[model samples]
Target: MRLPSKALIAILFATAALPAAAQDTAAVPQSATAAALECGDDFATWKQNLANEARTAGVGEKGLSALANATLDQKVLDRDRAQGVFSQTFTQFSERMISDYRLKHGAANLQKYGTYFAKGEQDYGVPGPVVAAFWALETDFGAVQGNFNSLNALVTLAHDCRRPDLFRPQIVPLMTLIDRNVLPADVKGAWAGEIGQTQILPSDYLARGVDGDGDGIVDLRNSPADVILTTARKIESRGWKRGEPWVQEIRVPAEMDWALTGRTNKLPLADWAKMGITNRDGSALQDNGLKAGVVLPMGRKGPAFLTYENYDVYLEWNQSATYTLTAAHLAARLAGQPAFDRGNPDAGLTGDAMKALQQKLHDKGYDVGGIDGILGTNTREAIRQEQMRLKLPVDGWPTDELLADL
Candidate 1:
């Protein structure tokens, strides 16, 4: 898919910082003669200059030519719009991912690749199912890998304004891949530009891609072993602890210290036990030497968890807490645990309702800024503020029940 022109324009505005007047002048439609003059006069020259920068950054002559010849397709832009929002609720996202599909597939995969999992666990310390969970989340047990051109997407994103600095370094390696024939010219992937079964970037693929199946080529597209092993390696790179569980559901006492329930406010396991934290099944917090922090993602009324360092490792795979929780929960289910007991309470808010909730929070002396529907830091802080004000145990997440009350 081609990148969106508006996105491209945004990128240009971000990178070049073109003056407002110049932008207005450039935006006006022109006839063919005027367009050719405008191209030579301004926009074409600017693009040519960026092309020169690309070539200097190690894009080979042919690679640079390919990029120059390419145009950002509106279809790609439409795809970006379509792919903007996640459809599942935090509960549904968790349920479907941790459902029978993952469990059955994970069990079969564990059995089929028992040796690999065992070896990987022994060698890398990351659990077999954790690796399998990543596989399920990333590619759905190898069912549907993405189909965007990695080169174009990365190039577009790198050159695009929003995060050009973040993605800029990727361009050279991406071009290098094209030049070295590591990635084919026709490679397709996700809209954000990730590629192959596990959705890795070119640089990551270059650094850690391995021929896990003994077939010689490290192709994640068709090889389950390569995807699994490479994902395990990525986790290892992020400091996955050997023989440690990522997180476990816990039972917190009604009057427990809510202050100790977040990554930002961590206390030792012993300290948590002293405050009356126990496993959901009523087991005592025995001498598992690993330190952990409590997290009540859905506030005090929902399930509480004691998240270990390995949970952070899972977070490195996907930054979202919800995404990480889903992966970890799915991993647990695959290893034979029941689904989470507390249902999600924030599933009912429509987009507009979410914004209204934010506004209500701001009105109630909470600091949720202008009611953007995005549940970002401001919204979260507002949730915490309300929880503190109401004297409920504060977890920063907003729940539908809480919104309704507001």
Candidate 2:
């Protein structure tokens, strides 16, 4: 998730900033060379380059001053590197994150912000539960928004060589917020430079934010109305379809073609029903034209989900499969669905074992999307392919036997 500090050895060497006439108007430039702010550049010179970028983006003197005042924090780099995998299975993660407190508050919030929820849905087509699920999971309904200095975090990430492509663009919007007095110059938020109750990034905040309370200010941190509406807008902007299912619990047959599973391998519900894939209650699945994938988060003998298009929105919010499932399940729970059946899945491989398995897979003509030790969608796809090749169970779980076979 982060580059090694040793790769930035040249950061101690300062260089002159690029002339403003040469820079483009993009919030973040496409090339480091275009801005003359290489990963190897010194920190002080990098800040000056960032100020130049902000200035070209139409930021005034005040915002330019905020950009200039921003400092690179090594602690931010440490956190970015430490941003790692969710090592829990679906059941364990859901059980932990969907606490009694969140359930109670999430339900109450549905009523507390009922007006805004309805308005948000009417306007943005995202339901209250979907938005509220994110609200509950991120920062606990605004109770625990991160305390890291937002300015420092943004500057630190933009200056860092690893993901400057992502963080660099966020600087202008953040400075814009400061310039407009919507946020202070020294705002505090998440380690990745996200702000507000839902921990939204500055770009999303700028693009999707709205003044929901009608007070003429988009105050996401303190106003429930603003938080609810703004979150709905963001989810809707991420391709959330109106009046569609996100995820539903399902019971798969004891024996079936596991190759038909995974998010990308979508099949009509009628076809899945022919394979005896039923609702969680053992009832026949509705033969609707809706297409869904049978998602086995912990392999075959584990919690199964019929993931629909709306589930992609959850993935967009956070890419971790465990976290995505937990968020979707929490949304369902908030909307009055019963608890999911926990199946006795086989134990998964340890982090080291998973990384080793990934390396082996990568070596043998598979793209596991880097050996991060996390079972992302691409990693799962590679595991399924390898399992099929080896005539294994093909459940997409990295088992010890699979490792030994490799």
Candidate 3:
């Protein structure tokens, strides 16, 4: 999740100030050659190159000045590289993100800003708890919006060769924000350059900003009303259906085919019911003429969920499975749902343990992919295959016992 610091800085300096005319010229060095240059070798050059890109992207003088003032922020780089969320299991991630403090504060914010949420729900047909869930998960109900300089962070990322393709295009919208004065030059936010109480990216803000506070300004950073309403608008624009459950924890029979359990593989409720799927409490699953996919983030040993169309809308906000699940589960909590029935808080294996397990599986001829210490689909599938080979319960969870046996 974090960029390689020395490599990123070297690339930023080496690519400095190459003119737009040089972009197509063979004389211009590639990102690889540029990344090998000395640190701060030609920072002015990089900034000027970025300025040219901004100009081409239609940014004006105010935007140019904002970019000019940006400094290479090592702290932003550190934060960008320290994203540990990917290493966390669903239980671990949920426990931390939907902490007791967050839940209590989120509920309070929902009440304190009841009228604003009510209006947002009414207008967008998005539920109040759903909006509140995003608010809470994003920045802990506005308690901890990160303090990194937005322009500097965005510029640094744009300059870095590690993910220039992804971060470079974001510079233009950020410049536009400065040009329009939607955000000040020194605005602070998450290291990836998301701003506001909801941690909206500059591009999303530009595309979906809404005035909810009746102050005639869509101030997402300061106005909870705007933040909530704009978030509602964003999810709606991203295809959030009115009156739909995002996801609900459910149980499937042991004999059910494991191949069908993923976000992309949808089946009708009737089919699932026929296979002995039930609600969390052993109740019958209602067939509502809707299709849902079974999602087992923690594999068979963990909880299962029937994810609906609105769940995909959550993906548009953040692509992480746990992130989307956290917000949706938080929404369920805010709406008085009970705790999930199947997750074990102690089931998470450490990163090193995961790597060891991956190595052991790899040695056994299982395609575990790269041993990055993150339990992606390939890793989980390998674990499942190993368990089946050993005649053990094929739950797909990497445990200390499993590692020891391997």
Candidate 4:
């Protein structure tokens, strides 16, 4: 269930470097009104209003000029509207993300850039394997960073009201970058606006950028050192514990309380051991004197993990649990861990079918929240309760038979 690498767009800024002289060089085009005729009047008006705000925020003339020709990208809108359901097993995700190509390439990159990794580890307290995992997972070590024009993507998303709050704020920092000439107007990235090696958002780039190379400028797209170290710093800023494990796959006893499953229970390791949880190989669970929550990724059957505080740092990077798990698992593999067992199960339901199932469960008062088709915590819990009611396997996963029954 790797998160679809649909653009990870973001903005960046060099606020202090933006001078009035630099702003004056790029003039706002007089044809903005005519270009509005192409993207529609609403988009034109939105751009104008935002441009005014950018001016007040010190974006200066060059940034305003860049925005004057901004065009709407339908692909960005389409990608935003699209939502995903986690259906792939851990084996599937691992095979796709941790392919031999990635493993070999990632290891090679680790060696090639050993100095940066070492400095990153020393400065940010994040391991080289973890940073490499992120690099491999996000844009495949920068090989497949999307080619969409990041400015157009951000402007289009900001104009679209569906999620303006999230996309609009990013525009200013990007304009700041343009004003400072740190990024060219034609710079491209994923459709969603994420840029650079780690596919970082613009706000994050501005906040967490590090001069990993000796050069003063933090060039994320071109400098692998900056990219890796920036990522390490960003995770450390987001509360990555220095030496704590992110997650460990574990075996659970048949009689273990199903209620204790999920990512928020926060039971101590000893308490979980008392409840019959142990290492995946059925060895006694080690008492690390730390609290952990159980993550039943595919319910009680597929794969279970004891997620520690560091797991939350992965969530901070990507909200999707599946995506975080992929990064963590990749990190483990890079550290020489073997593949874990994966149980065979039927193919999961599609997004539409899952939406219908969520609607059905919600209608039956199972509290699936809204019918967006995403199998979030509410929907999974609803499925679990319904499974219990129907005397079926209470794994919280949906099946065709369960849909028919509903």
Residue pairs whose backbone atoms clash in candidate 1: 11-161, 125-242, 147-189, 148-188, 148-189
lDDT of 3 at 188: 87
Local distance difference test scores for all models = 0.62, 0.78, 0.72, 0.72
Per-residue alpha-carbon lDDT of candidate 4 for residues 1-406, written as tens digits (9 for 90 to 100): 3433433311111111112112211233223232333343376666777787778777888889989978888976776665432444445545665677777888899999999999999998999999998887766787777777888987886666554444555677778777887788877876667778777666666667888887988788989989999989877977888878888888877666676677777888999999988898889998898889988766666677888889877766665566677778888878777665574445566568988998899889878757876666688878888877887767677889889888
lDDT-based ranking: 2, 3, 4, 1
> RMSD, each candidate, Å?
9.3, 7.1, 7.6, 7.3
* Tens-digit lDDT track of model 3 for 317-369: 66557667877998999988876875442365777878888888888787765
Alpha-carbon lDDT of model 2: 0.78
Candidate 1: segments with Cα more than 4 A from true spot: 1-62, 79-88, 343-350, 359-378, 399-406
Write the residue-wise lDDT of candidate 2 on 1-406 in tens digits: 1211221211100000011101212445456454335654887877776677677777888888888788888987876665353555567667877888788989999998999999999999998998898887776788777677888887787777775665666778889889888899999987777788877777767777889999999998899999999989888877899999999999998889988888777889999999989999999999667889889988889989999988877766666677778889999999999888888888888679889999999999888878888777788888998899999887898899889988
Give the top-scoring candidate (TM-score).
2
- In model 3, the runs with Cα more than 4 Å from the true position are 1-42, 343-348, 359-370, 381-396, 399-406
Residue-level lDDT of model 1, residues 1-406, one tens digit each, is 1222333322211111111112122112222233233232343453565566557665687666656654444444455444223323456446544656657777999999887777667767777888887676666666665555665665555444433443444445556566666677767765555566656666566666767788877887888778777767766866777778788888888777675577556567788888888878878887577788787766666678888888876655554566677778878877877777783334445478787888888787767645656554467667776777777657776667677667
Query: How many residue pairs in model 2 have overlapping backbones?
Result: 0
- Please state the error at residue 367 of candidate 4 in Å: 6.6
